[model samples]
Target: MASPQQYLNNPNVRKLLDVIASAEGVRHGYNTIFGNERFSNLSAHPNVRKSFRQTDGKTNFTTAAGRYQFLKGTWDGLSRQYNLKDFSPQSQDIGAIGLIMQKGALGDVLKGNYQAAIQKLGGTWASLPSSPYAQPKRSQAEINKLLGGSAQQGGYQPQYLSAKDEVRLFGKSQPQTIRQKYLSAEDEAKLFPQQQPPATRYLSAEDEVRLFQQSNQNTQQSSYLTPEQEAKLFPGG
Candidate 1:
């Protein structure tokens, strides 16, 4: 049977985790809480929920912590799946790998297929350059630089690359047209009407009473005892 620490044992996974921690902004501080605070718990996930102001002055609430900044609910499910014992460094790596495997990006990640891996994980962690979120992001070139690529190839900025530039950097691609994406809720509802459960049937008060009486009479009729049985039960009754 595979142990819970399987991902932590693999050298490739260890290296990948190091890179990912840097991307998530927790390389030096594993217990780095959301909004740049520090946590001191390792026994379990530090599910300290908080609302902090963003650079834009908007408030954002989070329970995100540790290297990958796992949300409480997200960690709960991943921990169960990966059998993570605690929020230790090893456990975090294993749990992070479990998430990568869940997204079908583990194979790509191990193969050093950066673009493919980042694309797969875009919607998951909002830190990657491929992510569509409006958060602070590490550019494609910047992350590649972490992977030991030249500064000329991987730019210095912490921003995304243009489509043309990305094509120039990484050869092949699969661009998603607007039509290929899923429809919005209202449009989807128009196309496929919401399915409702069948209505429940209920008997009237009069019908319920009649059914109870009929059932009681049937029970009595079915419970008929022989003369010998009646004599044994009630001698003179």
Candidate 2:
């Protein structure tokens, strides 16, 4: 694994990972990029810096704090190996870089292999919603824009069950029952303030995708919210 200094030595890799971090929602000092305010509000405080052992013989703590959303599980394996301190923003940033380096995406990232880098990093970042890995993938265009690079065309395969595949499986792609879906609590709170946000918890991309598939039969279905709904949800820009 590359040392934090070595990782830092390559500014482009750092920048790319920073873009991923931003995509992962690490915009604040004490919260994930999403609005998870109040660090001390959980069994394991969201802003917890040190790793702690829970009563169930498992460790519980904020591994996802800092600017990079470093999970405690990942940090547990990496902390001593890298001589990391606590879960400060700097520590989180370094840990994120370390994760990318460990995933073997560092070199590809430095070489401007956006899609390759995204593919490599996808193992760790679930937010890359469009990855073939079936995890939640963010927009490649948006990620590329953040990296100051042009979008890498193709190579991404959506993991959801497509309409054709659904038809093959169920004879008819559409589910017999289509219920009206409300905005996800996480999304509703962030996009629409009228509704109260639920307690914050880490929802993996797989969980999100599975829920998405359960909701709509069309694997390639578009936005959950229509333009009118979106306009109401996000009145501003």
Candidate 3:
């Protein structure tokens, strides 16, 4: 099983993570399977029904599990293909990439084909800006922000190409190592500063309950557990 640390060093994985981070943020530990408070069970959510191990007896609905919010059926197929051990943040990251590759969108992502990539991935992540399903949709600009493209400006910056190709296009190309082309610490820091990016936090069960209770009333209540459901989740108050 590849550890999160091991996956971290892989530039390809890091870049893919940037895409997920931009789309999902860290809400509900969207990109992590551990290292948070409340919702302690990374593999399951109290109000959610289905999990990789079992389904919640209350509602027969299948929960999208893990950081990438993969449904149990999806994870089952990916786990065997990738030999994943657990749904640790790293494992989940790997699983997501596998799905992207399966859809043939990895190259589009690396090449900064934001629209095409989003369209390809929309089938898997319903929240994608390109998805037809009605839900919170990420704008192409948000996705392009992480992709280092100019889509926000109505064009896309070409991804790092071969030095010869770069010279052919622009008459000059900065010397870059293969790894340097893929690694983007600056971009990661820009999107999610190390000091503290918005919404990534640890909360005690009480704090979590209170936080949700005080959340914006306008938000769709059905999207999250109701206070009554939460009370049932953490009983004996």
- Tell me the tens digit of each residue's lDDT in model 3 across 38-118: 355545323345322212233234456556667677888888887887766677777888887788777665565556767
Task: Encode model 2's per-residue lDDT on 14-52: one tens digit a residue.
Answer: 677667767776555434523343363222325345554
Flag regions of model 1 displaced more than 4 Å: 1-4, 53-58, 150-237
- List runs of model 2 lying over 4 Å from the truth: 29-35, 38-63, 130-136, 151-237
- What lDDT does each candidate get? 0.69, 0.60, 0.59
Name the lDDT of candidate 3: 0.59
Model 1, span 1-237: residue lDDT tens: 444355566666666666677888873467788877887788899899988665467878879899888889999998888777799977777778777787888777667665677688877787788888656788887788776662132346444445654444444565554223334555444444545333323444554564455564444332344565456444754
Ranking by lDDT: 1, 2, 3
Candidate that scores best on TM-score: 1
- In model 1, the number of clashes is 0
In candidate 1, position 41 carries an lDDT of 81
Deviation in angstroms for 199 in model 1? 89
Give the TM-score of each candidate: 0.57, 0.49, 0.48
| Candidate 2 TM-score, C-alpha based | 0.49
Clashes of 3: 0
Worst 10 residues of 1 by lDDT: 194-203
